[model samples]
Target: MFKSILVPFDGSQGAEAALAKAAELARLCGAELTLLTVYRHHSLLEASMHMVRPDEPADLDDIMRTHAKEVAERGRALAAESGIPAPRAFVKGGPVARTITSFAKEHGNDLTVIGSRGLGSLEGVLLGSVSHKVTSLSETPVLVV
Candidate 1:
């Protein structure tokens, strides 16, 4: 019954499971699947600043964008090969939960699929869990795979 399904991926195994589930659901329902990958811009910048020497120059935004694009490409390819219709790829820079919720609202997606991980209990309390946040905050139905 879903017209549009949004699947968020991060090149992790958990994300792969979510993508597979979303692809199957899309195929079964003849729905359009959208593969979303949110690049944690702030985190990446902080990481770059910590890893790189102060004197060294680095384009943190560009680097993170490239990585996000690659992750999206991989997810898109997998969905396409699995018989999901031409999956659209999106890359955003923000907190994962906010980005996902905003995308689902903006796209009018019937369903949002995301993997559970990355944010453990301690991390969830600190940074928050993307999947849990989306599930609790999203207006649309969210399936954590």
Candidate 2:
């Protein structure tokens, strides 16, 4: 039985499906459910590529982090609605799959549940889905929904 379950959420339909499944498992096992939303860190170099504008976000990383926080909260709400009263949620910026695995390891998660496909860029399609990469990289057991 899983004591702790981690779900990597990205505001995608696939991710929402994974969250629902993970929450169901957590409830069945009476496990603690954790949600994480990771945003891609945009370096200054990448920021410079975009045309500067007064209305545009001055710091892309900050904007990304802000959006990530919203996504995390939404996931938390979903988990709460699913039966877990108060699920823990977090927001981070980094390489998505690596960050997820690292967070799971750091937090001593027994199970990681993720979506088979998510809101990934073309790179994901070219290389592999985040779930695929996480399955390959993670030492903990991963369940892809």
Model 2: colliding residue pairs: none
TM-score, one value per model: 0.87, 0.94
lDDT of 1 by residue, 7-95 (tens): 98888888999999999999899999998998866565575674667765466778889989999999999999998767999999887
In candidate 1, which residue ranges exceed 4 Å CA deviation?
43-57, 118-122, 125-127
In order, the Cα lDDT scores of the candidates are 0.85, 0.92
Please provide, for model 2 over 46-69, each residue's C-alpha lDDT reduced to its tens digit, 9 standing for 90 to 100: 777666555676788888889899
Compare the candidates by lDDT and give the number of the best one. Answer: 2
Segments of candidate 2 deviating more than 4 angstroms: 43-45, 50-55
Per-candidate RMSD vs. true structure?
Answer: 2.7, 1.4
Q: Ten residues in a row with the worst lDDT in model 1?
A: 118-127
Point out the worst 10-residue segment of candidate 2 by lDDT. 49-58
